[model samples]
Target: MKKTQYSATRVDIISGHLTEVVDDLRLVDVADYIAFIRCELFGNIADIVNSATELTFYPDTLTFGLGGEYTLDWNTAPKVMLDLEFKNMGVNAYFRLTLGADSTEIDLHHVRFAETGRSPADNTALLAAAFENARLPQLTASENLG
Candidate 1:
């Protein structure tokens, strides 16, 4: 596997559009954090990569600005899959998530739950939850990654 880095430079904080927001740095951080959880849950990065599965979070774990305050203290803040569980709560998983392997890719069409019955607001969240935990599932085989 190869190591990947992403950024939210595409998001325009100053432009308040009707669309949703995506934080790139947070996305990368979330991916890193997911790998950590998956490694602990699965075994090694290789297992996770070989598993070739996309992870989704439970609706309950989809807790974001839903109902809480935040503390940016690294030493004191709630440690978790930070970005997934906290930062980009309103964003879709397809836009936020990626396959464990570069050769692999997510195929499901991600969209919002319109009155048209497309998908729910947290569609991606509901989409990626592999098990009970919203843990990410990949470990890059690069020298700097896994």
Candidate 2:
């Protein structure tokens, strides 16, 4: 199979909203916000590839989703999940961005995800920088990648 190189940038705008709960009760919320953005990026990359390489991304042949666990504390820095996807040949790739363990403040986390089977090396740096620039606030981390 021939290898095609592809790259794209996506942005998501998330709003901050949470329901009230018991004063001392503990809870965990599994938001599909990051998953949604990942799907959008995948679609964008697929479109670009189709236009440039004439290789269509058949829905039946492609699958995209997100799954992860997060913990929120009273004084802990806010968390933002940066999700990305890449597809080439028969391989799919994903990357994530979050507050680094050594990061002092909660800044934008740059997540770079890509799919393999293509010229993965061709635009790796460009794609990495693109995702790095698509940072958002932890509160609006679930916004759709535009």
Judged by TM-score, which candidate is best? 2
Candidate 2 stretches greater than 4 Å from native? 1-64, 82-84, 88-91, 99-146
Per-model TM-score, in order, reads 0.19, 0.25
Worst 10 residues of 1 by lDDT: 10-19
lDDT of 1 at 109: 23
Model 2: which ten-residue window has the lowest total lDDT? 16-25
lDDT of 1 by residue, 1-146 (tens): 12221112111111111011123213334345455554554233323322222233233433221111122344643323212222133333222222222221222223223224434323433333322233443346794474
**Model 2 error, position 22 (Å):** 31
Alpha-carbon RMSD, each predicted model = 18.2, 15.1
Q: How much lDDT does candidate 1 score?
A: 0.28
lDDT values for all models = 0.28, 0.31
| lDDT digits (tens) for residues 89-141 of candidate 2 | 33333433242233311112332344444354544544444433332233344
Candidate 1 vs. true structure, TM-score: 0.19
Candidate 1 residue pairs in backbone clash:
8-24, 55-128, 56-128, 56-129, 56-130, 113-119
Model 2: colliding residue pairs: 14-140, 86-114, 86-115, 93-114, 93-115, 95-113
